[model samples]
Target: MVVAVIADIVGSRRLRDRAAAQRMFDETIARVQREHPLADQPLQPTVGDEQQGVYSTLDDALAGVLLLQLALPEGIEFRYGLGIGEIRAIESAHRELTDGPGWWAAREAIETVHARQERAVPTARSWIVAAPGQDEGMESRVSTSNAYLLARDAIVVRMTERERRLAYGRIGGLSQSALAEQEGITQPAVSKALRSSGAAALLDGLALMTGERS
Candidate 1:
């Protein structure tokens, strides 16, 4: 089965300048493609402020989504929907269009996140829906996967700009001391910020996403 991630800007219409936001959104997607480069179908802006991509595994898709989320500029946030299943069709060649249960599930998942956001729910930015009958334990696995995403997104949404940079760097495999050098802060100060800002917990969650932890 393939994994798909569909994401859209949180408040595109409300933004003062749609053109600038679209430019930033496109740039963020390009950066993610360069840095992550794990998607089987590279992430690209499909329409307006929304983008979609396909990955070989759930871990890669989750990693890509988090990286893109962090790569976004200040005052810009996006919600994600992840799905895992077979692709049934490609509606367009040049546009890399696709039609499948996987895409449908992803669309449903993103809509769910949007509804949650509209209701002011906490940790409402990401959701996953594995295609039915893909496996006997699909339901249980989806629950566990979404539980992790909920906890991960909770920490992510609350991080300040500095904290986010630290978390992103750490997830990219940088040590605290290395990040300190890069951020021009003392090692101890970097450690303190990471601890206080939930970066440590977030990294652990990322490890879970990457299957580096039990």
Candidate 2:
């Protein structure tokens, strides 16, 4: 069986002070536990800013990732590194994977995100999967640049943003109102346009134009 490791931050330090950050972390931990009660997994606190988790399947890991991403409290975001490998159970709920190329690939994935984050890519929300010595597609749900771009389009449609001067802003342009006015339409029409396949196609095109895939 394949094991997946996930690591990510729990809250917003830049936007919150020590007290608020602690509260956010506690709340995030509680939320993750509540969401994965049946996983028999512990969401381990990492360093002072992040959390770590392990799962036995791609579905579990991916579900947990999507949940954490969507359920994250305001001002909080996450980055993830998922690696698949062999494991020896330490207990019914815990185990340790043999680490090597598999582990390194996972680290590289995270490092790639880190580098992109440093360059301010898509607000640094990223995920990676690795299964060394096996088929590459066995690890990542998004196995190609096209797949990744499609996922990005989905995210663009899913999230409502107010921040400007970001890639997302550039993708759809200033705001719904601005786009509406520029197109000589109502705000609701602009929203409808954003919800249409046209917006998705536009995002895909922008992704290609901007070289968003990695």
Candidate 3:
């Protein structure tokens, strides 16, 4: 079993330079993969405006997508769906194909997030669903993870570009002084942004999820 993900550009039609936006998206995904190394298959474009990836665990999926959210540049955004289940490949004469419960769950998740975005929660960017055969323990995890995703997306949507960069840096193990140098601000200012922007709490939550804390 694995955690599968589906993602797409949030406002594809409105992008001023579609090519550049895609390039940046690809680069950011590469950087996240390099820094985090959580994905079983690193996120990559699968078709027009869409991407896919695989993770070995739900925690990895959660952390990977969060890193992606912060690594992406201003004016570019993507929504993600994560699924936990089995996946299988279909043999094609010309090309490989993918199918199975994991992808189906991921599809459901993405559609759910899209619906949520159109409804009351416009900032919703990620959602999770589990395959029908998930055990009781897995189902409980799915419930808990969904709650985390909602709060994480809400905090991320409110962050300024600088705040996001700093948060991303912190998660990648950068010091506040280093982030301040990159942002051309004082180290104290970086600390203030990390606190005022809700990033510190988010990092703590991620740590707990990843077993970095008890």
Candidate 4:
């Protein structure tokens, strides 16, 4: 099975410089993909305010989305939804269209999260849903993942921009000293930012998602 992801830019219409914001968003996604090549198909704009991508696994989608969240500059963000299932393409004379349960689930998941954010949990930016017809373990997996995402989004929303930059660098395997130099701050300051902003916890969570730990 593959993981399909759909993302929508948040508040793009309200931005004064939509073109510049789009360029920045594209550049950041490119840089993150270079550092962590987890996507089967890199995210590409599909329509207004939306993008689509595929990953070989759910963990890749989760980690990839997190990288994107932390990498984005201040005042720009994307809400992400991931679905796991088989994907089939319908090729027409003009272009190929994706149609399958996976895409459907992704649509459903995105709608669910959008409604959720509007009502509450405004920081919640990512969610995953598995297409039905899986094994008995699907329910547990989905629930556990959603719970983790809720906490993850909350922590990320509370982080400062500098804290996010540090987190992104650390994910790319940069040392705290290295990040300090890049940010023009001392090592202790970088350490304090990571710890205080909950970036250290987010890093640990990402590591766990990627199976970097047993």
* Top candidate by lDDT: 3
Model 1 Cα lDDT, one tens digit per residue, 120-187: 77567999988777776777778888888777788888888888888777877788899999999999
**Cα lDDT for residue 73, candidate 4:** 88
Model 1 score (lDDT): 0.81
Off by over 4 Å in 2: 1-3, 10-15, 36-42, 88-104, 136-146, 149-214
Better of 1 and 4 by lDDT: 4
Poorly placed runs, candidate 1 (over 4 Å) = 91-94
Model 3, residue 16: what's the lDDT? 92
Candidate 1: lDDT of 80?
93
TM-score order of candidates, top first: 3, 4, 1, 2
lDDT of each prediction vs. the true structure?
Answer: 0.81, 0.51, 0.91, 0.87
Clashes of 4: 0
TM-score of each candidate?
A: 0.90, 0.56, 0.96, 0.95
Please say which candidate is ahead in TM-score: 1 or 4. Answer: 4
Weakest 10 consecutive residues, lDDT, candidate 1? 88-97
The Cα error of candidate 1 at residue 6, in Å, is 1.2
Best-fitting candidate, measured by TM-score?
3
The sequence of per-residue lDDT tens digits that candidate 2 reaches over residues 55-131 is 66654555455445544555656666655565443333454534444445556656666566567464555555565
Clashing residue pairs found in predicted model 2: none
Residue 118 alpha-carbon offset, candidate 2, angstroms = 2.6
lDDT of 4 by residue, 162-212 (tens): 999899889888999999999999999999999889889888987776687
